[model samples]
Target: GGKNLNDHALVEVLANEAKNGIEWLKTIDANLSQVGSFGGASVKRIHKPVNDEGKTVAVGSYLVPKLTKAAEDKGVQFVMETAATELVVTDGKVTGVKAGDTTYTGKAVILATGGFAANTEMVLKYKPSYEGFVCTNAPGMTGDGIVMATAIGADTVDMEQIQIHPTVSQETSALITEGLRGDGAILVNSEGKRFFDEVGTRDAVSAAEVAQPGGFAWLIVDNKMVEASSVIAGYIKQGLTVEGADVEALAAAMGVDGAALVETMDKWNACVEAGKDEEFGRTSFANKLDEGPYYAIKVAPGVHHTMGGLKINTNTEVLDASGNVIPGLYAAGEVTGGVHGANRLGGNAVADIIVFGRIAGQQAAAYAN
Candidate 1:
C-alpha cells in the first residue's frame, strides 16, 4: 500500500526477509502470537507479542530483553554509557571506532546508533518548522552514528524527512499506540465531534489535529477496549486517562458540550452498525463504543521517527557520496535511510531493524572473514 511512499527495492528486501526476522525472534523466545491491522496497512499484517498471561506486550519491551539475553548467552560484551566519537578509517576503509580515549579496532564496524529525533538542535537543523514540538524518542537518540559516518565521507539520504506521531501525551511526551485507533477508538476535537478519519496516516492525522480548535484532540475509548488491550490498560495505569461514567460525563470532564458529544456518540455508533463511516469515509471499524466507563486522553503531535540518515545498500554496507560502498563500514536500523522513502508505515520499523540488522551482521562477518 505504501509502495509509492517507500523505496521500492528496499521495500522488496524488507518484505522478503520479514518472516525470517520474525522466525529469528521466535528462535530467541519472542512470543509473537497474533496479527493485527495498523494505520495505512490494507490488511492485518502487524505481528505482535504476548506475555505469559496472554496479554499483548509492546513489541520493543518484549523483544529487547529477549535479544539482550540471547546475545549475553553467546558471550557478547555489554558496553554502557560510552558514545562512539569517531569512525577510524585506515587506508580508506573503516576499521574501528573511537570512544573517549579508547580505540577498539576490528575488521568491521556496524553503526546502530539510532536517529536524531531527541536532538533538538539537529531536528531543527533539518526541519525547522517543528521548532517547539516535543519528541518521543529516548534521550540517547542524538544521531551519533550519522555524525560519525558522515564525518568519514559516508553519504546520507532523506535528511529532512522527520515524522511526528499524532497521539502523544504532551505532559509526558509518551506516544500513545496506534492500536487504540485500530481497535475502534476515535478522536474528537474540543467541540466534541469527530473531525477526520480516526485511522488515517500519521502525517494526515497530525496535520488535522494541528488544524483543530485547540491544536489537540481527545482520544476516546471504552471499558471494552481496555479489557481487550493491555496496552490501553497500561496507559490508564500511567494516569494519562480521564474517566467518566458516561458520554455526557466524559464531555463535561473534557470541558466540551455534553449534548454535542452525546449526539456524536449516537451518530458514530450508528455508523459502526452500518459498517461505514458516512461522515469521514473511514473504512476500519472494530466495535461500537457503547459500553460504560468511557475514557479520554488529551493528545497532540510529537516528534517520533527521523526517517533519514546515513545511506546504505541492501547488503547493509554504508555508501559514500559517489554511490560506492565504504569498505568495512555497515549500518542498520534508524541509522540508515532509504528503507522508508517519504512516509513510514506503522509496524514496519521493527521489521526494518530486524531484517537489516541481521543483514549488516552477516555482511560484516563475511567481510571480516
Candidate 2:
C-alpha cells in the first residue's frame, strides 16, 4: 500500500505508459473523451457508448480489439480459447509456451495473462479468508501467466497483497467505480447511519462496511446526483439499484429502519447544507438526499485486483529468485507485479499495462532482432 505513493518509480513507469496508451488509443478511434477524478487523482478514460445493463467500458475493451485488428492486418497469428499450461524452458531460457499438448515456439515471450482473482483454488491457497467473497474477474483470469512463469523458477513479489474494492454490487459483484462517490454518493450501514467518510481510502471504507452488521452497506444518492453521472444507468439497468420517491420509501425498499433512515438523511442533508461532514469527516458532500426519487445500492467489499506477481525491472524483464534476469522471458500487466505494492488505486491498472506492456514489447522485440 505504501509502496506506490507519489513519485514512486513504479508510479512513474505506469504513468508514462498510460500516457502512451492514451495516445495509442487515438490512433484506433478510441480516443480519450472523459476524465474521472477520484481521491485527488484523475484518470483519462476512452470513449465508449453502452446502454444500461451494459458492461463498464474499459480501455482494454476498445484498445485490445483495435490492437488485435491491427495485429491481424500485419499477419500476426491469433490463437483463441486456449490455456497456457507450461513454459518451454531450455538451457535456462524460456523458448516458448506450451498450451495444451501443442508448443508455440518463439525467440522471446511476454506473459500478459492477467491476475488469478477468478481462480477459487488459488485464492484460497493465497488468502483463505477470502474464500466466500465475490470476484469481479473473468473466469479465465486464473493466473496462468504466474503459474507458467513460476514453473520456470521466476521470482514473485507481493503475492499476499490483493485488493478488495470498497464498492461492488452485492449480488453480481460488479465494481461500482469509486468515481460515483468521488462525484458524490454517501454510504450508510444497516442502522441507517453514516459510518465512514464516503470519500475515504478504499481500505478504510471497506473495513468499516465489513464491521457493520451484514458486512455490507448502502450507497444513497438523489436524482440530481444520478443525473450528473452516467454510472447509475448501468446499475439501474442491471437491477443492482433500487429507487424510491423519498427516504421513507427508499428505506422500506432496502428493508432498513425507516425512521433511522430518515434521521440519517436529515443529518447527511445538514452536512451538505453546511458544506461540512462533521459526523464522518466526509469532504465531498456534493449533493443532498433531499430530492424526491432517491436511490440506494447495496454494496460490499469483493476481490477486485491482485497487486503481486512476477518480479520485474524497469525494462520489464522477468527476474529469478536471486534477482537475475530470465533471458528471453518478459512480463507485463497484472501478470507482473510490484507496481502497486499493497493496494492498487482505481486508474493505475490501466497505466501499469500501458507503461510496462510497451517496455516488454520493445525489449522482447530488440532481443529477438
Candidate 3:
C-alpha cells in the first residue's frame, strides 16, 4: 500500500488483473441474491468506466449497479421488502424467515444484510469504543441480518475492527470516493503543503489522514486530475467541494490561511516534479498537481464500515455458540466475517459482496433443496 490510495485506488487494484491479488476469484462459481446498491436501489445504472483523462472519477461504490443487475438476472431473486424479523428454525435446522406479516420458507437461509454501524444502539451494545463520528454504511444498515441470525444462535467476530474512513467532507460528510487518491490526488492541510500522499489502500490512507495535525485535512484536486478521473466528477455531483480558481481562494473560502496553503503547494509541487513524496511516498506514475483551477474540500473523520459480524464457514453457513453448524443457515457479503481477517483492504468489500454473495446464494439455494 503506497501513499494516497483512495477508493478508486482500491477499485483499480481489484479490477486490474495484474494488481488484484485474487485474480482467480473472478472465475469462482456462485450466484447473487440482492445486488442493488443498499441505499439507492432504484436508479438504473450500468457498468461503464468513465475517465476524463488517465484520471477517473470517484465512481466506486460498495455495490456496482450493473453487476447488481447481473446478479439479479443470474439467480438472485431480490426480495427488497422489510428486513427479516425472525428466523424460523425447527430441530436445529433453519427453515425460513419472517419478512413482514407473511412467512417465507426456504431449505437454507443466507443472512448477508450488512453491519450495524448505522445502528447506534447495536454499536453501543456490541462495540462501545466507537463513540465519535457517524457510522459509514447506509442508515438502513442496522444489523438486522446479524441480530436475526444471533437470535437463532450465532457468534460474531472482530467486533472491534470497525473501518472508519477518518475523513469525510464538512458539509454533508460526503464520501469522496477512495478512487480519487489512487490516481495520485493529494491531501493538504489548511497550510497547503502535503499531509498524506493520497495514493495507497483506503485503510492505510485513512489512518494517515487521522494521525495528522488536527485530525482534519483537505482533499485537494486539480482541474486536470478532475477531468481525467471519475473520482472528481462523482464528488462534484455529490457537492463535496467548494471550488476555487487558485489555492489561496480555496483556502480563504474554507477559512484557512492563504499563504500557508501557497507554501504547502510550493513544497508539494516540488515533490510532484521530483517524483517522490518524502513524507508519504505517493507513487509518481501519473499526472502531478500542475493543473489550474485547483479545488479543495474540507474533510474530517467519519465511520465508513464495521468489520465485525456473524461468523460462518466457507460454505456460508452461520454457526451457533458451541461451534455447531446451524444447518439450513448461510451468510454472504458483509454479514459474514473471516474474509477480512482482522482488517479489510480498501476494495475487498466489493469483491466480498459479489464473491461471497454468490457463495451464500448458491449454498442457500442448494440447502433449500
User: Which numbered prediction scores highest in TM-score against the true structure?
Assistant: 1
In order, the Cα lDDT scores of the candidates are: 0.90, 0.79, 0.64
Clash pairs for candidate 1: none
| Model 2 root mean square deviation, Cα atoms | 3.3
What's each prediction's TM-score? 0.97, 0.88, 0.79
For residues 6-107, could you state the per-residue lDDT of candidate 1 as single tens digits? Answer: 567878999999999989888998857778777776677889987676666788898899989999999999889998899999999999999999999999
Winner on TM-score between 1 and 3 is 1
- RMSD values for the candidates in order, in angstroms, are 1.2, 3.3, 7.4
- Stretches off by above 4 angstroms in model 1 are 1-5
Per-residue lDDT value at 330 in model 1: 97
- Once fitted onto the true fold, the runs of candidate 3 whose alpha carbons sit more than 4 angstroms away are 1-48, 51-64, 71-77, 200-214
**Candidate 2, overall lDDT?**
0.79
Candidate 1 Cα deviation (angstroms), residue 208:
0.5
Judged by lDDT against the true structure, how good is candidate 3? 0.64
Between candidates 2 and 3, the TM-score winner: 2
Better candidate number, 1 or 2, judged by lDDT = 1
Q: Rank the candidates by lDDT, best first.
A: 1, 2, 3
